[model samples]
Structures are given as structure tokens and as C-alpha cells.
Target: MQSVDVAYAEEWKMDHGIMVPLHFLTPRYDMDIIPVNINCQGPPLTPLNRVWEFGKALRRACDSVPEKIAVIGTGGISHWPATPNSVKIVEEWDRDYLDKWLANDKEALLAYTDEDTLKDAGQGGFEIRTLTAISGLCEGKKGDLWFYEPIPIFSVGCTVGVMEV
Candidate 1:
């Protein structure tokens, strides 16, 4: 096991990233939740390769416990949010990413550099870290893309998927 320092939030606010999905999946809001956030928006961001390793480590940690756990990774696919190109939705880029993600192609997924993501998919594409982590957790397992649509109004490609773990 890798020795890494884990930080805890003293005060937590349920951001839309977690709340929107939970609002649909757990309407009752009774179940416990542990939110994991990847630094997709800031400098010194975690590298894609390290993100994959983190996901693998997380899987091992979850497996060490007896309780049933469900991990949900939520994020926008390819859209330029809060920028002059906010209306832009890179459908081609999103589709290509979804293709690799569904196949759990680690090589393809990790091949993305921040510069490439920024150039092709815009800043919002950084959120793929969360989805890529899910891919890592389900390494060697394929996933299903249940729904994916570019919702210009929302400025994101609304996506829902599940990976076999």
C-alpha cells in the first residue's frame, strides 16, 4: 500500500457535483456519503497517471472493509464554462473520451495532457480526472454509457455511466 497523507474537511458544503447526482440516486438522502475531490481546477493538479494510481489505491482501501460501498464519479465532459467560449461544446472530444472511458482504456485515458484537454475540450475537460479515476478503480473492466448528451443550456455534456468493478 502506498503511504499518502489524507486530508479531511472540517466544514463541508454539499456542492452540486455531489448533490445533483445524489438528488436523483438517493432522494431520501439517508445514506452516508464520503466525497472525494480531485484538484481538477487548480494549478499543481495531480497528474493523470497518479490519478489512476489513486483510484487503484482507493479500490484496495474499499476492499479492505466489509461494508458495501458505492462510488459515484460526477463531472462535465467537454464544455467551456465561465469563459468567453462558454457556449462551446466539443462533442467530438467528448465522444472520443467517452469511448476510451467506457472501454477502460487506461493507456488512452492517461494519454491526455492538460494542454491537450485545454486546447480541445476547454478548461471544463479537467473534470475528466474524476471519471478517469473511476476507470482506474474498474481496471480491466468495461463500463456502459447509459446516457450522454450535449446540453448546451447546461454548458456541459450530461453523462451517466457505470463501470464493472
Candidate 2:
């Protein structure tokens, strides 16, 4: 997990590098103790365009390590998690996001720093960064849109899916 907070605290953008893997600190996920790449470069607060480098680094790790790796990038398709956006949801953007994922459109996927993502989609939409990176990691692989729903409780356009090599 690349400590984006720590890295950001030092005023650095996470370009390309893997951070120490941490044990599932909390019960949020039931993932194994194995290393999980945590790319925090794109958070709800300040999202950076580190997608290209971030994905490359993960690809490198997957190839270098002897263990089988399954990289799962999780985040909202759109919808800001805080502020005035807490009550809003962008189903259109979410659907389009899933569409791009299912189609494996890397170019379009990495090209979403538009005002819609922040202004309309809300700050939470920044989470798309992780999804963006994952798609890059699984370039040329087949991915399925397992499920998608915009839950109002959390005010996020949630997506559950898989990308298989």
C-alpha cells in the first residue's frame, strides 16, 4: 500500500513505486494477509494524474513476485463522498463508467479529469483513479461488470466487477 497520506504529507505525488504491504488493519475487507498494492494517489481530497505510473508499478510487482496476485481496485464510479455532494448521485456518469470498463476502453477511461467528474460527479468521483489504474494493470484482459448500483445511503455510484487475465 503506497502511503499516499505520508507521501502527500511530504508533498510528493506517488509516481511509481510499491509501498510496504500492511495486514488488513481493520475488518473492512476479508482479504488475505498477502501483499496488496494500495495506491492512494487518488483520494477523495486531492486526486492526481498518477494513473499511468501507478498501474505500471503494480504490473511490475505482479511479474516480479513469486506468488499469484489478484489486483482488485475498489472505488465509486462517481459521486462525491462529502460536502454538498453527500445527497447527490450521478447514475449517468456511473453507467458510462461501467460501460467503459466493460468495453476495456483505456483511452477514454484515463481521460476523465473533466469538470463533470468533480462538479457534477462530486469529489468522491476521484475514486475513479483506482479503477483507472486497475484497468491499466489488466490491459487486454477480459473484464465483466458483475454488478452496479448507486446506493443512496453512502451517496456513491458503487460498482462490483472483475477483470480476469
Candidate 3:
């Protein structure tokens, strides 16, 4: 397993190489893959159990592929509850979460609910997707912190990091 902090999808692809079994997973709220649902109110709240199901599916996909199971988690720094220093706080939380994640413990990762998470870091709730991705990758195995870098811009924050299982 290997890890790298990156910003752009092209950069990640360039580094990891083409032809990898890539799985781009993002929070439905922040996800730009499909048309943005502007009519939808706040970001969609994902049921914890539903996320677990998706994790299981991801694991099955990796098993089927058997190699080059590259999972990319995108988005960070929530945008609700409006507060100062939210970006920094979110970055810190993300770092700590990754630290625990590397240890292969889902309890710590899954303990926080979407509401609590959003209230804690405002827009940083966006980071939840990253946590979910890490959880899926770790899959009960120790995740080694490979990289961590937080970028704050436009009153928002974006953190890019990776871990190896």
C-alpha cells in the first residue's frame, strides 16, 4: 500500500498511472460527477449504515480486481454553521482522524454523526467523505499515513492525503 497527497484528479492519475481500477468516491453533497442538484437543500445526509454497505461493496470490487485498487476520496472543509477558523479546525480534525484511521479502527471514524461533524467544523463536514474512503480502504487493517497536506482557500478548506492498508 502507498499514499500521496494531491489536488487535481489529473495529477493523481499521472502519478498513479493510467489503467488503474479507479474508484472516485465523493459525498453526494459535494459530488460534481452527476449534475449538481441546486434545487436540493443542504448536502444530502448519508445514513451510517448505508455508507457501510457501500464500503462492503468497495471491498468486493477490490477483491474482484485483485490489483490496482485505487480509491480516490475528494472534498473537504464543511460550509455550514458559518464560523471563523473553521478551516483550520477541520484540517486538524482530518489529521487526527487519519492518524486513528491508519490504526485500522473504525469506531473512532464512525463515531461522529453528520450533524455533529457539521456543527463541529462547519463546512469541514465535507471531510467526512474522506473519512469514509479511508475506512473503506483500511477495511479493518492498519492504515499507515502516507501523506497529509491541507489547503485553505476562498474561505474554505481542502485537504489531500493518502494511506496504505
lDDT per model, in order? Answer: 0.89, 0.64, 0.50
Q: What TM-score does each of the candidates earn?
A: 0.95, 0.71, 0.57
Candidate 3 lDDT over 105-126, as tens digits, reads 6777667676676666565464
Q: Is candidate 2 or candidate 3 better by TM-score?
A: 2
- Is 1 or 2 the stronger prediction by lDDT? 1
The candidate scoring highest on TM-score is 1
Per-residue alpha-carbon lDDT of model 2 for 87-134, expressed as tens digits? 588898788888887776877787777466767677667677777777
Error of 2 at 75 (Å): 1.2
The candidate 3 region of ten consecutive residues with least summed lDDT is 32-41
Ranking by lDDT: 1, 2, 3
**Model 2 per-residue lDDT at 85:** 58
Ranking by TM-score: 1, 2, 3
Q: The CA-based lDDT of model 1 is what?
A: 0.89
Cα misplacement distance, residue 62 of candidate 1 (Å): 1.3
